[model samples]
Target: MTGARTADPPYLASLRAGYDRAFEATVVATPPEGVVLSQSLFYPVGGGQEADHGTLVTPDGIRVAVVDVRRMSGAVVHRLEKGGLVRFRIGMTVRGEIDWARRYTHMRLHTAQHLLSALAFDRYGLRTSEAAMSGHGGYLDLEGMLDGEEPIRRLEEEANSRYFTQPVQVESAMVSRAEFEAMPGRSSAKSLPQGISSVRLVLIEGIDRCPCGGTHVLSTGEVGRVRVFRDPKGKVASTRLSFELLEEREGPSSPP
Candidate 1:
């Protein structure tokens, strides 16, 4: 893969990828241990989602711990733990596995973000100005001032109402600018990089649909419960909403 930029989008099949994570790929570049691959299972850090962490086991049984993944100059780069360079070499075949448990949590929270952001835009005319996600929880900053009393609670009710009424079946599609602009739930493109002509849209059915590159849950039901909280010392000029995802269980709980 030397000097060749990946022509095909680097990922698994959209339909099957919703549930599958493991795949085989060849090392096209090395030294830093993340350069190019015949195909990549790792989601590079972008669009408010963290990169995947896992182990790359060679055909000969050597293991390289993947600590971070990124993309530069159109090449996907996987930064490895110390000593990884000593164990890996170019032209080696390896099995690539993503940290699915952590990735899944981000997926759940990410999908929940789409629904919540859409609700803010649809109901309150607020656009998502910025967002971030991690394994445990995350937050979205809206592009408008929230003036009503108990706004966080109200947002939670609106989001959860739509979330619970629907199954969490997720669908992703690639489309041009015009096609994406036609979607109903489109919100602030803050989380997206500028100058992107093609759009990757992940839809939570009717609840929300937006341009995004982050991994999301297979469906909204997987999101369980969504709680919206406020930052202390009252509000900022633009509303910032912090949220957490809780799994379905007796009484109350948060995902571990």
Candidate 2:
């Protein structure tokens, strides 16, 4: 994908809290399908993760549905829904926002992914190849093959234990690729984009650490219980482990 959070250019603001923050951004470029923004809180489709969907509204309240967000040459491109091509203009300033529920769901799942990847490597010496998430569930593709439901069951057990069981905090930081390489962690199946010399590393207190760019919850407990699917057939050349979140139904979780 686009490396990790460290890969973010200095000109753009951190999307860590973009869903709650409103910013005025000028349109930098407009193709037939989408427009590039000066800065974006929307997580684009990268690292096997899906792009965010949302709306862009003018200061006058004129709004357009943003169907997709993609990254091209370091810029975040917002693709509008069908019709309304003229709703935006190159130089026009608008308020860019993302679907909060979708973004937060991804945040939770992505963090869980980091946990899963770390567990696989720590317990089985397998490194993650690729991953993608939706809603409260997603899958992790690793380099090795897995057999039987027992392995997956063990994953569920370790994941729940390794994840937030005692209210530990989650953290993100930018580090050069050299530091990323030196540190102990799981590496994704895909390499970071060319020319990227830095990475954003996500850390879970007492659990695991890895480089990632997707949004994530502040606390590990908010990630809830990680449940893995019990199917050996899902394994191909690479083992594809699927997992979902069983969020605590009690109340809202505090941000880390």
lDDT scores for all predictions?
0.70, 0.70
Q: Model 1 Cα RMSD, Å?
A: 4.4
Candidate 2 Cα lDDT to native:
0.70
Residue-wise C-alpha lDDT for candidate 1, range 1-256, written one tens digit per residue: 3563433444433734644466677767763445466667778887888888877888888777789987766667778777676666677777877767776777777778788888888788887877888866788888778876577788898777767445756788888776666655545444446787887777777656777777776667777777788655334688888888766322112222
Task: Report the Cα lDDT for residue 39, model 1.
Answer: 68
Per-residue lDDT over 1-256 for candidate 2, one digit per residue giving the tens place of the 0 to 100 score: 1321113432123434533534577877677657777767677887756777888997679888888877766667778878755777777888976676676777778778888887888888888877888767898887887777787788888778856454567777778877776775566424666677977777777767777777766676767887887435445678888888777332233221
Predicted structure with the largest TM-score when compared to the true one: 1
Off by over 4 Å in 2: 1-21, 162-165, 188-190, 230-237, 248-256
